[model samples]
Target: MKKTLIVVCTLFTFGATAGTEDSGNELSYEHFVHSDKPIKCLYGYAAEKVGDHDAAIAIFEDCIARWESVYAMIWLAQIYDTGIGVPQNLEKAAALLKRGAHTQDEAGYSSLAKYHYGILLLEGRGVPVNKQAGIEWLQRAADEGVDEAKDYLQSMP
Candidate 1:
């Protein structure tokens, strides 16, 4: 019994150390993008899934800088809106979403923009309170296939 216990503890300690070492070698978002194009999106999304918001945001920012795609803006807006990897700054999030909205054909910010903007309007966080304008933007997003906008419109009365 004593030998069995010692072996178990030794294996556990080794596994823990290995896990720590692996984590220390984890890549940042910026690195992920330049490291492998084929896996950038997947790696970024996976990092976010693991709660490394800063890394994910950095990766997305790099992607946006390089590609100028709305997808990166949308993700960045999400991070800012939720305060995932940084402080929650609705104004910055709104601005990014707006920029993305302009660049994207019709599906730029989607539900994220509408939902967060709607919440901001309700709370008057970043922009002035303009329920009407908020509703209009939300409707646009919904029409563009933002599911949250559809629900928002329904609740707007």
Candidate 2:
């Protein structure tokens, strides 16, 4: 019984210490995005998932510079909006989202940017509050099969 108690206490101490250590460094983006893989943005996603927001921001910025990736713009906008590893800059976030929305519309991709941008506009998060413009943007996103935008529009009497 004494041996069992010692072992349990040791295990508990180790577990608590390990939990306090920064484990984010253990998760490498290289593990997720291989050089041979066509999708390089996965590295940014992996970095963000591992709580390495600075790395994620750099990776996303690189991807955007190289490919003008609309998804990267949206992700970067979110980072700026939430102040994740950086100061909160709503205007920058709004600009990034606007660029993403335009790129998505031009590329005929999903309307995720539109949905986010519409919400920002509606709430005056980073721009002038314009319900009409916000509704129009949301309507466009809804037409493109964004269920959240559809639901939001429905909720608005």
Candidate 3:
């Protein structure tokens, strides 16, 4: 655990410093990783938005391992699914989405996760096509206020 923390901290420190003026700031990445609140987990999104996928992947991987963060899982899943900064791996993407779906925290986040997982199932991206299961997941997402899921369900045949 200590080794992992050190590695994660190093990654975060470099990522945090990149494109920032804080060249010599003594920022403690461990504090964010160990914090009870997960405010810093969203940094991966900024990395993703700026096309720094390597940093995003590292940050999101940290978030999932440390906090099981829903958004991080979803973002990483997309990166894998789309081959963004890495080779496409549908199975990996689906697996991450599966974990996100089973996550008990963050209900709204789970809804979005379920919606994405349902699409993968419906399209057989990495798993066998199970329309019934896909529809069920989509329905759950719709019930939880996922607008895209509602639209998908409404447009279903």
lDDT (10s digit) by residue, model 2, range 75-133 = 88988999988999999999988888777434443388888999999999999998998
* Cα lDDT tens digits for candidate 1, 2-90: 43245445534543222122234444434464543433533455457568776777667776777664656766776787887789987
Tell me each candidate's TM-score.
Answer: 0.65, 0.74, 0.76
Residue pairs with backbone overlap in model 1? none
Compared with the true structure, the alpha-carbon lDDT of candidate 3 equals 0.75
Order of candidates by TM-score, top first?
3, 2, 1
lDDT of 3 by residue, 1-157 (tens): 2433554566566665333333244243333333334545655665566686776787788778888888788889989999989999999999999889878564357778899999989999988999999999899889988889999999988
> Least lDDT summed over 10 consecutive residues: which range in candidate 3?
17-26
lDDT of 1: 0.61
Rank candidates by lDDT, best first.
Answer: 3, 2, 1
Cα RMSD for candidates in order: 11.4, 11.9, 8.5
Error of 3 at 48 (Å): 1.4
